[model samples]
Target: MMRSLGKQTVRTHYQHIVAGVHDPEHDHTHETRQTVYERPDGTFQINYMSGKRFVMATNDGSFECVHVVQTVRSASGSTIMSVIAGAQSLAVNRLNAVIEFESGDRWIEIEDDETARLAAGLTQTAVGHFYHEEERLEGRHLRRWFVLVGPSEDLAVVGKVALFVLPPHETSVDPEVVDCHIAGYRNGNPYPEFAAEIEALAAATDLPITPNYMGDPVVTPPATGRTPGL
Candidate 1:
């Protein structure tokens, strides 16, 4: 289970070590002492390095994910600090995955592999907005197709599962547009089975189905494959 803000209020202190330091007159080692206070209602505070402080709070529990990144630069004592908050951890994971994927070869070959293709499709559905305008539009269109078929709880599950199986920093289609180009045959009638396959794949991989923000139960598919009139 993902980390949740529960009734486990605690305070802790630790040393964060920074490696690979070379100083002419010093011992060539450095570490920072940090203190953290976590509350049961998902609020937390951190203090480090001469009164520098970071804090986060949740009111109605809309936000659940938080990430802190520290970057060190070679140029004359340069450092960067970043804090990110999200509604769910999956979004943050997918963002990290996209970043890693983009930092390397953006293009890859799907080679008619069904699983890879499916993964690509789900990526398009989920984070395609991170891509260029054309590719983002494509993703929007595909999402529209799913919406037209009527909203199902499985849609989000399939999307998250696909993201889990996707290769790090790689896409089988054109990296420029981040296009998956799923076949037309799989779009309309076969979508239910397609969704089922994705769920099965996720189960095979032991990927947990992320609960909705409200923690609702999963529902069955609607009787009609396509939404009425479209």
Candidate 2:
């Protein structure tokens, strides 16, 4: 040891310490609906529910916008059939194919294959039906109607009439526009009384009416004497 005193060595010891800092609680209920952003590219994107960004795009670098006016979901949240049904209801029309006239006070409704497939996925019944009849000396009239009886007891009737516009004209209830206008019925029965509303809707969006008889005709009820009551 004395002889080795000329050579000396140094040693050091290091110890590590770890600790966690307490974090404040957050109120998730205070969170607001995620805002959709319009990108510089003229496209809109939103990350909604489960990290899915529903995107709408345009070919000309224009933005596609959509306001989700409604939503439906199953209690388990795993079954989105109701939402699909609602979406289909919003986008599909009464006349996806040719109309077949059936005679009777009761009409047998039939939907096109595409409409039927979409409707079938959401409900246990027909997506909708078509009723038609011919006049003695006049042309035939067809009415396409959809009846959606809600799980919450709400009832809705969706009707689309076909019309004839002149040459170089387009059909009313064109499948594309029809889907967007379908939301109009969500407020009330899409009947003759809603003609003004329909016309307004059509005018605002430049939607053309079909070239056939697709709109409801206004009919005034006949006057009658008051019935005697016991």
Candidate 3:
């Protein structure tokens, strides 16, 4: 006798037939026993010892069978070398912007601006690079400035300036330094407009003037010009 079963009914009928013939005490020396797995996606995976096989039923009421041969082979020396070369090439292509200062201190720029901004809030000191055009009589020439906001002592010497903070906003870039007062400078020099305020604060705390030099090359700003509501 022969009978056809629907997709949903096939699983139940198949399980019943398989259970009736399955041997629990079968020996594996000749061949491995069949194993059935019911997937959550309403699919059955039947495994055999010889090779891999997949039986799939499609929505068009057709069955597709795939047989994959499994083989084990040792890696050759050339294959291992090729894999290492590919890994090295991938690493070189994914390198990020990093800076090493003369004082042996290194600062790696965060890939994301928002993440960098959040990180800056956890520290009392921060350094950033900004692009601004000083409004001079010479038609506003663009200039790149490195900003440092930290303790007076750290700012006083170029070798001590270690903090590096990426600006948050893309356009109106500004580094956020928390609980820091009486410190703000650009290109290792105190802001000209805030010179009086800085001097007063320094005098009160006996802080020395920061050197007028940055020990490393000026960092290029990621973007130029100001944007509203970035």
lDDT of 3: 0.28
Model 1, residue 220: displacement in angstroms? 1.2
Model 3 lDDT tens row, 1-230: 22223222111111111223433332111111123344666665543223434445547544444322222223553333234335533432343424332333222233343323322321212221111111121233222122122223322212112222112322222222111222222222223433433233334333342222222222332332332110
On a 0 to 100 scale, what is the lDDT of residue 122 in model 1? Answer: 43
Query: How far does residue 124 in candidate 2 sit from its true spot (Å)?
Result: 11
Which stretch of 10 consecutive residues in model 1 shows the poorest summed lDDT? Answer: 142-151
RMSD of each: 19.6, 27.3, 26.0
As a whole number from 0 to 100, the lDDT of residue 9 in candidate 2 is: 15
Off by over 4 Å in 1: 1-55, 62-194, 199-216, 223-230
Model 3 regions lying over 4 Å from their true place:
1-97, 113-118, 125-230
lDDT (Cα atoms) of all candidates against the true structure? 0.28, 0.29, 0.28
Name the 10 consecutive residues with the lowest summed lDDT in model 3. 9-18
* Residues 16-62, model 1: lDDT tens digits: 22234432331122111123455565555443322424344447422
Model 2 lDDT tens row, 119-227? 3233322122111111111232222333222222331212232222222232333232122212112122234433433344334335443311122232432223332
Q: Give the Cα RMSD of candidate 2.
A: 27.3
For every model shown, what is its TM-score relative to the native structure?
A: 0.21, 0.21, 0.17
- Please report the candidate that would top lDDT against the real structure: 2
